[model samples]
Target: MASWSEAVEAAVRRHVAAAGSPFTRQALIDAELDAIVADVGSAGATPHQTLSRELQHLRDMGLLEFFAPGVYRWAGSLDEPMRAGTSKGVFVVGSHSIYQDEPERFYRFGPQWLPNASRIAGNWIIYQEPRRAGPRGYYAVAKVERIVPDPATEGMYLAVIEPGSYLELGRDVAFQFDGKAVERGLLNPDGRLNNGRAVQSIRTISDEDFNRIVGLGLIEDEDLLPRVDDPMPARVQEEHIPWEGPVDRATMLVSRTVRDRQFRKRVLDVYDCRCALTGMKLINGGGRAEAQAAHIKSVAAGGPDRVTNGIALSGTVHWMFDRGLISLSDEGAILLSRKINDIEGVSKLIYPNGRARLPGGVSRPDARYLEWHRRECFHA
Candidate 1:
């Protein structure tokens, strides 16, 4: 039989897995802890205290984490579970493996050693090998057909790609994936990937990097495009390309130029192109885009370009939000920090009820990132 602490830990893990998000003490009490209340109190801690201790135990054991004092986030689905402070959909080291059954397809196991591969089986389109191996590559982008696990193996996940889905760089030059930059591509400054030899095969790439990598040009053939059904990989003329060179404006615009547009489109579409804080959906003349995509975590701080990191805003509200004049709460409440001394100006622009509009589907801002804005970026 499991000890009381282990039982508590299991209950919390189940709660997190079921909720599909973080969980809190209240949630635990209401959902799985009610029956065990007396048992918990017998251990000298109240239900709340027992739960807290169990959560701490989990933290120590690297099972789950405290997003806040009461909240815990768990991604118990990936084959290699993402670590704390890392973003979702990041690659798992040592997860990518060659398919013994079919050479055309590759395996990417993740979130855990024996993870439920079905969580991310569908709805993903592309997968890119992060490292640039040998002389003839940077990344090989592939289209995911489905994910499967070896029934005999625990957490053995595979992101199976269509044959010929990988786009290759035939040229000799390779660039590494920075958090969001490819400065010289030799290796990232932050060291997330060392010389493109990150141990994992390939994890799900986030939307921001997906868009960026899709636009990356070859060193010799700058416009090489790959077809998934083609067995012959697209190859540019192999050339001796050095790590550092004078990049043209077109080459440098790949990530930001393409991704920023997608970010703005997603943000504005979710909010109907209205400013979430002020409800201003301004249209100048033609059907040109007027709403801007503003990052809750600014680009300088390494925020991904996914819709969750952005909000649709009018010009003035965007300016104020970026400068820390305003922030959104974890509960979607619009918060003007203590720095706003001009009450009249702020009040005229803000929503009377003070709630930032939530997106309809999955575009809801991560409370973790929202809390980050409140702590690091908000004026208060």
Candidate 2:
């Protein structure tokens, strides 16, 4: 009887030498084991049982991970799972395994000895006309053809490509898929999957591809791809408020950019969705009209890009407040900048001139940034 280590090494070498194109476990039993055992003078003429036992022992030692039943691969040595933050998020480490049974589903199996595989399954994104009804959802399953990151979204994450999404092959031609496009029988069809019923599958175009398409005049800015956090400012009446002192154009530009999408949501969440300027509450209509994230110290002047440095303001008040035309005192009083009083034709703008609403149970703005804005940006 050969030593366990020697037997395992011999088995691995034999498995490799056969050079099967689509390597399957049965191939090992059919060719390599019989020849190797005959040469090794092993007592057992048939080495399939011995090889199976040895492979199981190797799994116990953590050298390999079983992605699916009877499927194995090298376990990454140094990778370990890490906690994301104080939030209930976790980061996992695993390998990208291409399933041979179902090609559409891509799976990532963790390195733990469990009965079932723990993995992130591919989901289908269905596309249909706006009011059209049917099975409108994405189904999660194990099998993936391609994975790429979406740059337009805030957090960096990968999206698995689903079949049937439009693909442009040449300058003026496009191809669409109806069936499992990639190689079939690559993944288990009945395995765990995520079905995205409401999410629509739009064809993914890479940034580079988009630039090329734009250069060719295939699409325009209005038809540009929708980002994950694009902000559409609801239209409101413009207020022409008089300023008592000089207005700062640079400061106003900086402030406007800060109110853009990236910093808006966090600021709104920090402020509990109430307008700091008017304390206006829109409990109905999904709270869309009342509150918005307003930058305390404008993005142009090096203010931090986060909720800690933002204030929630109503749509009407945010415009008047941002143009260096208004501000808030440390005592939380409304301070209409002198620019407001000095400028001609500015008195018509509706200004929240008295007690300003402040966010509940939140820390006040940093004095340094606020002072900088007041000294450099405030019209007064």
- Which candidate's TM-score is highest? 1
Q: Write the per-residue lDDT of candidate 1 for residues 1-380, one digit (tens) a residue.
A: 12356446545644654565677778877887743432222334466776677778777877776788877776344333222211112222212444332212545443232222232343233233343343222323333456566564553556665443333222212334434344222123443334232332332334454444445533322221222232433331234558884343223323343344445555666788788888877675545445667878766665655567778887778778888888888888888767788877888787888787778554688676688888897887
Give the Cα-based TM-score of candidate 2 against the true structure.
0.31
Flag regions of model 1 displaced more than 4 Å.
1-254
Span of ten consecutive residues with least summed lDDT in model 1: 85-94
- Worst 10-residue stretch by lDDT in candidate 2? 81-90
lDDT of 2 by residue, 1-380 (tens): 22434445434433543352224456656755643343233536446777778667656867545656666664422122111111100111112223221212222221220101111113222112222333211111112223333243432224343432211111221111243311111112342111211121222222232332222312122211122243543322224568866442212212223224334555555566677766665544333435666668665565554444577776666777778787777767767766564543433332336655555443466566568768877877
User: What C-alpha lDDT do the candidate models reach, one value each?
Assistant: 0.52, 0.40
